[model samples]
Target chain A: MTSSDLQEQLNIKALNLLQGDADKIEKLIEIQMENLDTRYCPLYEEVLDTQVYGFSKEVDFAIRAGLVSEPVGKQLISNLERNLSVLYEAMNNKTQAAE
Target chain B: MTSSDLQEQLNIKALNLLQGDADKIEKLIEIQMENLDTRYCPLYEEVLDTQVYGFSKEVDFAIRAGLVSEPVGKQLISNLERNLSVLYEAMNNKTQAAE
Candidate 1:
């Protein structure tokens, strides 16, 4: 697959992993796949639009949804938390510079 | 203060609370207030430029840095994880709808 396609798939995979109840989590996210499906699943599109960055949301979403092993999920969340802490500092530091 | 000033102040307060070592943490983040100060504190403004969203980053950054009480930090992180999970699902569902 092309890079964009791969990105789309990974994004989808990460997202699927983040949803509720891993055991029951479906590999195929049954959203409205097209114009024909939209009538049934409108919430799908509305939510994807929210711009939440970083790793914890991705990992936590997966763990709580039951898509990943709990340990792995926790690891990802921890890593993100640490990195973002630095980034948070960096961002604030940057803002200070800007002013 | 006007709402904008309040936002700027809260944002500053949150950023200050998120930095390292609470007991030793200073309330005033001493960034270069102007051209005169810029030579010394460049990292200050650089950090605030990154666009990280949600509560966990806000709270965890604070706790790990020793700026906040651990209990309060954990509670914020928990709430963010839960809410973000729902948002992740919703976003994926939205993407599915888009297709």
Candidate 2:
């Protein structure tokens, strides 16, 4: 593979690895949020919001910079959305548990 | 206050809150990495690397957009560096623990 191809491959691999880490972080945030006070919910949510925004921007940058293909970006985004939904459910569960 | 001032103030507040969240996430990643196999360390590190890069970009964007003062951006970046150092120490500790 050419150097450009190698870079694209690395970007794709990084995105996949990032997805896995995002899943793990989501689970960890859920568990931590459960034990913390309600006041911290907004804080945690803000962090996640910033992260999601950042990740989305990075995906777009990767596509525009020709570091990754459109399909790869789309798949990464899909995984991000799925992970976010899981996070939302975890947050809801924590709220229910607190009540 | 002018609308611009209000926006800058909000940005500063968000940066401060983000700093707090970064600290928490650093701790969480540290703890999680301790239990997980060594293979996962690079994955976690990539997520963090991406995050830090994203954050630095955001900070620069904020300054360029006049959403935050240069000093405010500097402080935020400084906080980021501190948190990252702590994270590095955690990673080092994890490696030592595994040895």
Candidate 3:
């Protein structure tokens, strides 16, 4: 799946986990804010489109939409792997070069 | 970051996006089930500990727990990259071997 797709999947997984206990929902959003500042958080949150205080919608779409027929797009995950591999090799090469 | 940490982070991001719309929540869970069967989904669902219909707690904790002081633990996302890289190499190697 594309990173965007993986992202959506991850988002879906997160919301499926929250289940509106209010307390837990509150806690989860708090962490989300840590990564996404208030300005950014709302923009992402807008995906779900509830004036509700917690849970982001874009993330949920993956789950609601039945994304599981596919875990992540094969190519997207593959590209992520390739990018990482390059990063890993570069880091290793740099270290060896320095050594 | 560890896959688990990334898992948590993904979960957090997911919840932060949902913000409690019941219809969205329902759709989200349904998609979630596509990936996680009902029995598994609920078990994961219980992570949030809400009698509520949607959202999983384990996923939400990443968002709520102030986990951002760190993002997916660098090593985790990196490892995900590594594993994927190996798969990439192995697939290529097999194709080359076949040729």
Candidate 4:
């Protein structure tokens, strides 16, 4: 393979790994969303926040290391954040309903 | 550059970027250690923990993405953790002395 081909392969691999991590976080959100009726778990929020923070760091490193472009990295993070916000909004609604 | 050359370059870049991040965290520890005589600040601990967590994530990603070797990535994290532990021990001693 040529240098460009190798670079392309590496970029794709990096993006896939990041997407997989995002999916794990998304699954966490989905689980919490499904269990909205259960008592609100602060620990879940902390874990989610920590996961997101770690993910952003990974994306940032990928960009800095040239494994991923800045635009692509940022988009991945924003997409995850949007989904997270939806989860938070649902949680808030559930809490208000309980109150 | 050849494919192998490109790969080697990326590996070095990834390691350097991780080291740079580790240095930043080390600086944070140094700053906190210098101010140990001042009243203890829980915020510093929180920030340090968060930074270390993020750094570890970056190192993990680098390892997964095939940019850095697992041993090298883990060593970078352990070195930072050691310094962080030293800072925490100093803080604990200071607190005990004050009491």
Top candidate on TM-score is: 4
RMSD each, Å: 21.8, 17.7, 21.0, 1.1
Candidate 4 per-residue lDDT over residues A22-92, each given as its tens digit:
99999999999888887568688779989999999999999999989999999999988998899889988
Measured over the true interface residues after superposition, the C-alpha RMSD of each candidate is: 15.6, 17.1, 9.0, 0.4
Q: List-wise, what DockQ does each model earn?
A: 0.02, 0.04, 0.03, 0.95
lDDT of 2 by residue, A1-99 (tens): 454455445555545644664575566556655655544455776666666666565555445444457897787767766766776776777679979
Q: List the residue pairs that clash in candidate 2.
A: none
lDDT of 2 by residue, B1-99 (tens): 554455445455546644554575566556655655544456776677666767665555445434357897787767766766777777777679979
| Best lDDT among the predictions, by candidate number | 4
- Model 3 stretches with alpha carbons more than 4 Å out: A1-58, A61-99, B1-65
Which structure is stronger by TM-score: 2 or 4? 4
Q: Write the per-residue lDDT of candidate 1 for residues A1-99, one digit (tens) a residue.
A: 454454344445554434332222121122222222224333533332222243344454334333346787776555434543554454455557758
Decide which is better by DockQ, 1 or 2. 2
Task: TM-score each candidate.
Answer: 0.23, 0.39, 0.22, 0.97
Could you tell me the TM-score of candidate 4? 0.97
Chain A only: TM-score per candidate: 0.35, 0.62, 0.32, 0.94
| Model 2 chain A lDDT-worst window of ten | A58-67
- lDDT score of residue A70 within candidate 2: 85
Query: What is the full ranking by lDDT, best candidate first?
Result: 4, 2, 1, 3
Full ranking by DockQ:
4, 2, 3, 1
Docking class of 1: incorrect
For B1-99, candidate 3 gives per-residue lDDT tens digits of 555665566555544444333334444445544543223333534322231312332233444433322344333324333433444354455557758
